[model samples]
Target: MDFSLSSEQREIQDLAYKFAKNEMIPVAHEYDEQGKFPTEIFKKAWELGLLNTCIPAEYGGSGFSAVDGVLICEALAYGCMGMNSSFMANDLALLPIVIGGNDAQKKKFLTPFTEEFKIASFCLTEPGNGSDAGGIKTTIKDGGDHWIINGEKMWITNAGYANLFVVYGTIDVNLKHKGISAIVVDPKSPGIEVGKKEDKMGHRASDTRGVRFNNVKVAKENMLGKPGEGWAIAMATLDHSRPLVASSALGGSQHALDLSIKYSKERNQFGVAIAKHQAVQFMIAEMGMKVACARLLVHKAAWMCDQGERNTEIASYAKAFASDSCMQITTDAVQIYGGYGYSREYPVEKLMRDAKLLQIYEGTSQIQRLVMARELLK
Candidate 1:
């Protein structure tokens, strides 16, 4: 099997890499320290058409395949995951519409993305429910031509500034997953409250906040897919998104590996470069190995999506394996840097912090395993 990127894919990858190195890397530390969103960088990415790569060309998007998007994600993530998340949040919010919305719905909800650099958020996890998506406590009530939604969503990326939210709520508690429905809600609607931004351990430059929907009303046309289809839509979106998440992890791991290697070669110890040390060499070797293997799995999953295959199981595998690998690789990178790695002055510490969230979000590593096991059994 061929394992090479096409000319177009290479072009996209190179573009993203240059942008990340020149724009993101320099300011990543500053943004992390200030805990501020990198709006200027995000705008640059948008202007380059990097922000909405997956939307179809007909809808004003570049219509890049899932594999193409993964390449871009990996490149950008190598520079800064916090900044990467701010840009990737646009994809996370819109994928559901791409997967489930009708023509008219797409026109109304997605066309705006083509016109301007607007942000949207995916609202799923609540204060109490994370891994147990079916147990979400948000509730929705039918009001003839409209629906009234009431709930609180936590850990919502881009919630602080999102113009729209793809919300999930239950129509009947007893029905569990079957009762869930997905709806698009304007963040400006009455009674919608965006809480304070979260103080996170990593990805601080990406906006994360609590959103409360208090009797927010939306037209029935805003519902994505049929009633009771939210669970499937959510799962499908995650399946498609897992590869992007894995690519982000892969990028961070690669960055960590690159930093460790450069530092080892330059830092002298006992009148010789540390690269000559066997122990340091082994660490770098392992780091390189992990990054390589994770990239294969990520690209494989993305390829499956582009091929119209049932990728749920492979997506879980890629997400779980790549994220777990990144965590280990980044940690080892810190270890290789010795005491300097632990210092905030060095970039490895932030890479370690950012690598952590990869294992937790999209789907926790444990949750990914559960999903894989279920798919295997079937």
Candidate 2:
């Protein structure tokens, strides 16, 4: 088993991290404070082929494997997870098409994204339920020439800014998962209402809103697979996306640890540098170990995905462990910074806020555990 990155992978990693450092880091705090999306940064990233890395090469994307995709996510996320959400959310929105759409569908829906910088939202979560995807209240019905959709989707990332939306709805509420369908819809359609952007606790720089669909018309050509296949497509997208989420968690954890280590060496306590103290050393030591272990899990999951293996169990492991570790590591980083970390004047506080959403989104940490349990029992 080779542990080292290929030279090309290293180059990708370096470029992403450098872009994050140079472009994202400077404005992350301001964007977070203002609760604004960093459109210019996203434009720069898209131009460099860093934003839409997952669309197939045939469609003009970088065609990076899952492992390659995670590497880019990790490095960019290291700069600012909030800003990184805009980048990562693009993959989330596009994955359903990549996973389930036919070649022609890909050409029509995904090709334009690779050619130009655009935003999209994965509309699965609803006002009724999030983790219970089958419980979504959104409804879709046949309209002969077009599919008519009516419902509300909550906590939709990139909703306010999205040019397109991959919507999930049930044809029959009684059928639950069996009745679900996935359709790509243009947000400009009549009866589509994009709510005001959400005031989120973290990832504030990412555009998240509630989108309401009132009999919105969708092209049949935009349907993903046959009807009633949306649930499977959504699950498959989540399974593929969880690894990138884990990698992003790894980025946040690594960033926090770096800050903690730097702060510890410079911070003085009781006549000595905090780095010289055993208590601080122990926290830093545990953080280092946690980051390393989480990275392995993330890479393992991404590697499995790249190998065409179904990784439901391992993806859960990575997502749960890495996101939980990120929350812990960022918290510890604040502890190390000792009061200043609580202030917006420091970066770790923002990281702490951002790390939180990692656990909550892309399947919550508790949901990840249940997934692992189900896989094991099965």
Candidate 3:
């Protein structure tokens, strides 16, 4: 099997790498410290056509495959995961429409992303519902020509600045997953409230906020699919998205590893460089191994998606393994720096912080294992 990237893929990878190194790395620390969204950097990425890379060509997107998108994410994430997340949020919000929406819906909702740099959010998790997506308390009531939606969504990325939202709510609480439906809502719609931005542990530069919809009105034409299709749309979107998440984690792991290696060789102890010590050598070795393995898993899952394969199991495997690996690798990177690693002045500390949210969002590592188990059993 060929493992090499095609020339076009290599070009995309190189472009992303240069943009990350030249633009993102320099300002990442400042954004994190200020807890502000990197709007300028995001605009640059949008100008580069880095956002909405996966929308079909007919919609004016480049129509890059999942594998192509993964490559871009890994490179961009290596510079700053928070910034990468801000850019990637656009894809997460648009995928459901790409997967389920009709041509007219695509023209209305998806076309804007191609013509302009507009942000969109996917609203699913609530204050009480994260892993239990089917248990969301949001309600969608039929309102003749429109739907009235009422609910609170927590941990919504891009919510603070999003122009539109892809919201999921239920027609009846008792119907569980079957009651769920997907709809698009304009962020400026009446009764919509965007709460304060979250003070997160990592990805601080990526906008995360609470959104409350109080009897919000949504036109019937905004429905993604027929009633009861929200669950399927949500699950399918996650299956496709998990690999990109894994790629982001892989990028963080690689960045941390790079820092550790450079520092180990430059810093000296016992009258010699730390890289000479077997203990330090071993740590570096393990970090390298984990990054490699995680990349392979992420790529395999993305490849499966591009090939039109149902990748629920492999997607879980990639997300779980890559995120777990990233956490460990980043931690080890900090250890390699000793006291300096613990300091906020160094890049490794930031890498460690960024590595954390990868495990929690998209799907927690524990939730991924549960998904894998169910897929295996079935």
Candidate 4:
């Protein structure tokens, strides 16, 4: 029955929001306009223990829980989701290692990230693959003392600046999911090429590009679990990280609501404040409800993850509903702002554009529905 955040959670929330207000909000538009990654902001966030918060203390990390992660994500996304994506991609890239790596593997791969400001990219979706992970054409083969990888991964976030890449490939394309394996790769390895940065429609502040592995060599010890176990590892990674996506979307929705409420009260329309109009009130009310429900769903999923429970269904529910709702909420906010909302000078326009990628990534709303259906049938 208690809905309050624990004292620890509240303190985490305060620290995150303070950083967001001080650092992210002021420069979000500047970076977005230039389509540049916020390196300074990221360095500051890292200094504050905001970036890469989940690696265990033994590995020189804070070992924060899933709920703690959601709180930080929401606050950062509220400032700017584009910057938040750069942060979230680290968690996305690292989750597979935490879920499937042995002690030695974890120590070797994850420890350096904590020691300094670094970035990583998750390499799963291919040039021809988006929702269908099993349809990937990438290949990873056994070499005598090492592993060899060859593939082109598309739509990889933080690809341009990543120091490390977590790659997924198949031993035999005919075997599909059964042939899949996950391996960690050094981006500096020979035969690796990073394509030109993509000119994206939104989240322009995050570096994204295609990565081609001609014949990349990786240490044999870098593979996570056994050869056929990658499919499960990928699935588990999604289940755990989907809520983080939901939290980001939730933050965007809350931001849209806050902006709308402020504008409605200040803007005079027909000789009175727009807040006095019933039509405006209705839209505002709907926006408020969307924010409230989405927060509940987002938090529930994150809570389940921290408890080590099976949350595949709830995670999908949160990611789908929260992201879809964020798009709606941002769009409606623009509507309330009328002509001004469409212009780049105002913040809502960027939010509306940024809100879009949330639905498209981390599993589209349609894909999440299918996941829910499959789980229900089982």
The candidate scoring highest on lDDT is 3
lDDT of 1 by residue, 1-378 (tens): 999999989999999999999999999999999999988888888889888776888888888999999999999999899989878888988999999999998888888898898998999999999999999889988988899999899999999889889999999889999999999999999989999999999999999999999999999999999988999999889988999999999999999999999999998998999999999999999988888888999999999999999898888889988889889988998998899999999999999999999999999999999998998898
Candidate number that wins on lDDT, 2 or 3: 3
Please, what is the TM-score per model? 0.99, 0.99, 0.99, 0.98
lDDT agreement of model 3 with the native = 0.93
lDDT of 2 at 370: 96
Q: Cα miss at 246, model 3 (Å)? A: 0.4
Q: What are the per-residue Cα lDDT tens digits for candidate 4 across 40-98?
A: 88888888889876687888889898989999999999989999999999989988998
Write candidate 3's Cα lDDT for 50-123 as tens digits: 88877999988898999999999999999899988988888999999999899999989998889988998999
Specify the poorest-scoring 10-residue window by lDDT in model 4.
51-60
For candidate 2, lDDT tens digit of each residue in 160-228?
889889999999999989999999999899999999998989999999999999999888888899999
Evaluate all candidate structures by whole-model CA lDDT and list the values in order: 0.92, 0.92, 0.93, 0.92
Candidate 3 clash figure, as a count: 0
Listed per model in order, the count of residue pairs whose N, CA or C atoms clash below 3 Å is 0, 0, 0, 0
